[model samples]
Target: MAARHSRKLLRPLLYTSAAAAAGAGVLYISYRPRNIPGLEAPAVPPPGYREGKLVPPSFPSIKSRLEQIQDLKRSNDEEEYDLLIIGGGATGAGIALDAATRGLKVAVVERDDFSSGTSSKSTKLVHGGVRYLEKAVWELDYNQ
Candidate 1:
């Protein structure tokens, strides 16, 4: 009976030791220091960091709608715009802003107020519906 009890205790101890060794091996392999390309700390600090301090970028002041419209008219009379975006909805406004930031002359023409169209009616949910995907596939609508 004593020998049988010791065998049972020894079996558990052996298993526990094996598990601990495996865990340690995994931890060491994962945490080992090694030089990895693109993972190294940048020699030069990124933009906006000066002398170990973060400096926020200065942005131009927001222009009122009237001012923007006047500017648009002035630009239209002076020179042709590189891009003319119709509608000031989320997508259109975003594209306009992106183009303008890239040094392109962009003008956005909205029927009504900005975001008053379909953008304002959005439920703000970002999800891919299986039913919509099925419909798109069945109808051969690649745009969807």
Candidate 2:
């Protein structure tokens, strides 16, 4: 009877150990750094970021909303943007960044605050659309 009781406890312990091992394996797989193609070198820390903490940069006096709007208008009238993004959400912001990085003048105009639109309601998963994949297969379009 004692042996059977011990066996029951051992079975649960064995199951718990297996679960812990599985969880650890998943964590290792998820967090393990892999070498990316174009990012061979280590990333440089952003400005105002130092030693595991962010050192906020000193800025000029904060402008009022009206002043900011006037400044934006002046800049918009003076400079021509190669790409003008309608939204300031994730997709628009990403496009603007890419364009600016490629030496293009990019302007993003948002009606609401950045990411206040559809970008805010994200699952946080980077995934390709299955519909697009299906379409690609059907049309034999490798670029899709």
lDDT of candidates 1 onward, in order: 0.75, 0.71
Residue 48 alpha-carbon offset, candidate 1, angstroms: 1.9
Whole-model lDDT, model 2: 0.71
Cα lDDT of model 2 by residue, 28-49, tens digit? 9999878544454324433586
Local accuracy of candidate 1 as per-residue lDDT tens digits, 56-116: 6665577888898898877745698999989777677767766766668888888888768
Q: Any runs in candidate 2 off by more than 4 Å, and if so which?
A: 1-68, 76-78, 119-144
Please provide TM-scores, in order, for all candidate models, with all chains considered together.
0.38, 0.40
Which 10-residue window of candidate 2 scores lowest in summed lDDT? 119-128
Candidate 2's TM-score reads: 0.40
